[model samples]
Target: MHESLSFLAATYVGQPIWLWLAFLAFIGLLLWIDLGVVNNKDGVVSAKKSAGMWASFSAIAVAFGAYVYFVYEPDPLYYMSPDNLNQQAVLQYFTGYLLETALAFDNIFVIGMIFTFFAVPREYQHRVLFWGIMGAIVFRAIFISLGAAIVNEFTWVLFIFAAFLIYTGWKMIFGGDHEMDLNKNPVLKFLRKRMNITDTIENHNFFVKKPDPKGSGRLVLFATPLFLALVMVEVVDVIFAVDSVPAIFAVTKDPFIVYTSNIFAILGLRSMYFMLAEAVARFKYLKYGLSMVLVLIGVKIIWNFGLYKGWKDMTGEALVPYLEPQWSLIATLGLIGGSMAYSWIKTRGEQNPA
Candidate 1:
């Protein structure tokens, strides 16, 4: 296992810096076209157009993934190995991206709840999501940094995080829980009681009008409802990140790959949220599927640690377990794809019975 990790790390570390730069540049160009050119319209993205954007965004990600595989870590030396540098990079990228995107579906559910609670206007929904993503970027950066520091300083931390993942996954799969009860939400209730709130949403404003210092005009900053909802968004994201960050760490300790995969998936989340909100209700079985993934990965992490120590003591040899990474990658992909397929089929079958 150590040798395999060393080889994998070597391939990544030896990749040329220029290749990474080109990849970033391409993503930037795509962002430019998306915000500057395509999103010039004022209203919500229609379903047909949303479908197109999804296709385009996915294509860009896949193309960029291919570019990274070939340019950075092109396999050489007869190129016939079942395992090669390009294949490894692609697998890692897909695994990371899939985890981020799959978990993002949960985010859409919360966003829906937030918007409904605050009564935000349909036209301004994108703005909230845009700013929410910005906040997520900052929050995830802090989380990744803290997580890396802890994992490095204490080797046993992985076991604790793994146990938590397994527990959360099990609860999600078997607990049959949904619909967060407001009475149980202490923070939200506390904020509502403490803050002054307006009865009606004024011109899609988030807060009640307040007097400006200079007496220029009424200021419309974070209103009580908006503030409460944003808080919910941040809190929800933190919970989701707990499962996702550790899963990514299992893939590769390289911060660059982890951070980049997170960035690409998050960049598309605003559009994805709008696209998936109505459809999320149909995916009754998805939570179970995601739970299965979390348990599998958590077991893999614990097993990896145990396997390494077991081999070292028994044979006086450092061995990293074989196919652990590949199994994780394959299982993560299967859970996501299979869940979505099942959800789609169930929804369609119910709509038009056989």
Candidate 2:
């Protein structure tokens, strides 16, 4: 037992194992307080209540950033200088958090659609989202670990990520049809064929025992619409992560920064969805902002690579200087903020012309 505990305390990936354990404990506590304490009785979440929860979660995330700023010690080899490491780590965390949160707005829209297609009740929606977020946490951790390993081993993989981001962004900007039909979803189709699924929800239960339809006396476990909705939600996140994980990596390669920022953004997703579901349509221009963000980050990645390689033989000395994290953070915030501002103003003007 002593040796096992000692091994668990040892450092991995630049931070002590205890730090990772602490983070996991913190997340587990938040989940408990959310599902078991504050929302012990499941019901419809009012927008007002959701707004308050969103603010509280955002505050916690910001406070966590402060903790990282003050407590984290960046390795001297990876950082530019020890004097600025704390500030840089904090900035990267917030930047990544903001980017992931902004990108997740799209997820909210998709989730809302999924629930609508399934005719999921407002009261039951939160339960699905709660479990969906739990699945997302696990999926994102896997993706982040795999991505970090790939980037660390083959620096050229960053270029591929950059290219993919650019391609996805360009499609978002130019693509006209984003509508999805849940009935046509491959996962749903496959599950329907393989499993005993019921057309109606059975309270909030995902699975329930029911009489088999084939004239058999034995009861069979059947999946409810709620379960299918949960599965769809999980699959939707996986699709979004392909774009978002790369975008965060473009900000910083540190696993701690990457993982914490992604989790923090996702932790508040349920509240965010409740707060914005009805009004998300007003932010029509936000997609343009998101697309631009991806394009800019893609460009930044390529530019950073060029700086290291002397700009493809254009000069003996390196050209296209590498962008500092501070500048990247500023750029990211400006683009997202400006886009949102434009969206709000445009929508408001249309709603009430002066």
Provide the overall lDDT of each model, using Cα atoms, as 2-decimal numbers. 0.69, 0.87
Off by over 4 Å in 2: 76-83, 308-317, 349-354
All models, RMSD in angstroms: 7.2, 2.5
TM-score of each: 0.78, 0.94
| Candidate 2 residue pairs in backbone clash | none
Model 1 C-alpha lDDT per residue in residues 195-268, reported as the tens digit of each score: 65655555544566666545778774435555566677777777788878987776655445566677678777
Q: lDDT of candidate 2?
A: 0.87
Instruction: Quote the lDDT for 289 in model 1.
Output: 80
Cα shift from native, residue 183, model 2 (Å): 1.4
lDDT of 2 by residue, 1-354 (tens): 888689677876667788889898999999989999888876999999999989999999999998988888765544534568888888888989999999988898899999999999999998999899999999998999898888878878888989998998899889864678888889999999999999899999999999989989899999999999999999999999999999998888788899999999998899999998888877788888888889888988888775645474676666656577787788879988999888888888475322
Off by over 4 Å in 1: 1-37, 71-89, 182-197, 204-227, 317-321, 349-354
